[model samples]
Target: MASRWVLVAVSAAQLAAGAAGQVIALSEGRAFDIDVLGFRGSPARLGRDSWLLGTGLSAPVLMLSVQAVATIRLAAGSSRGATRVLGSLGALMTCGYLIEKEARGALSPAGWNPTTTPAVAAGLTLAVTMAVLGPRQASSSS
Candidate 1:
């Protein structure tokens, strides 16, 4: 029970970290390509906001929303194979994103990125939590 709450909190913190990064990037006028579906769909450029929404229409919003729902499902202990798969994918995606950001010079390559370090830590925690949960149990219905 307590473990579930910890997972949820960590997941939320990771999500929050992501949101904060977007806000900062937008405020700093950092022009970057946001993946529409994370290597699936076309990348959309985010910069030069006209209405000031910035990233409100970006895919991260959708991604974070899905993650939020997944965290709730995991907390309910109803998550199984798909949950693990998505969790791993999300963590890997975060890694890839950080690397990309570094390459793009949005993040300092000399050392850790102050803006994204929390995301990395929270993401690592979530990944470990999912690993500790292991694979899905064999269904009793079988």
Candidate 2:
């Protein structure tokens, strides 16, 4: 929130999260609803089990709107609220990535994912920490 770099980092994380959701949904296949992806189709035909699927930073319009508006607010340097929202969104995105990977493999086999990258991991952590705990307080010279 203090530096432009943090804003860029958070924004980048948001974009990554959006992409990650799409990839996860595609990989999920069955419960992946076209409706959730902005098209029209009932997930019932695919035997939808978990609402968690087709959700996250790619959940229809909610995430998109939230991310868009929040990013704008942040870029304007207008609100800490924006950072909080950004942080929360980042956490959700990171969680989706992690959950999908873990369900596929319990720290075991099955190749890699965007979430596996160290930069992605660090970015998400920083964003989440910013949201939940706010930017680190500067040490007082007093």
Per-model TM values vs. the true structure:
0.53, 0.50
Q: In model 2, which regions exceed 4 Å deviation?
A: 1-4, 27-61, 101-108, 113-142
Which of the numbered candidates is closest to the native, going by highest TM-score? 1
Residue 76 of model 2 has an lDDT of: 71
Steric clash count of candidate 1: 0
- TM-score attained by model 1: 0.53
For model 1, the superposed segments whose C-alpha errors exceed 4 Å read 33-44, 47-59, 102-142
Q: Write the per-residue lDDT of candidate 1 for residues 42-113, one digit (tens) a residue.
A: 224554431232232122455666666777776677455435544554555454454443213433456456
Tens digits of per-residue lDDT for model 2 on 1-142?
2554465455656565555544554455424333323533334533243333443224333564676687777677646576667666656655544544332232234434454343334434544554543232111111
Q: What C-alpha lDDT, on a 0 to 100 scale, does residue 26 get in candidate 2?
A: 42
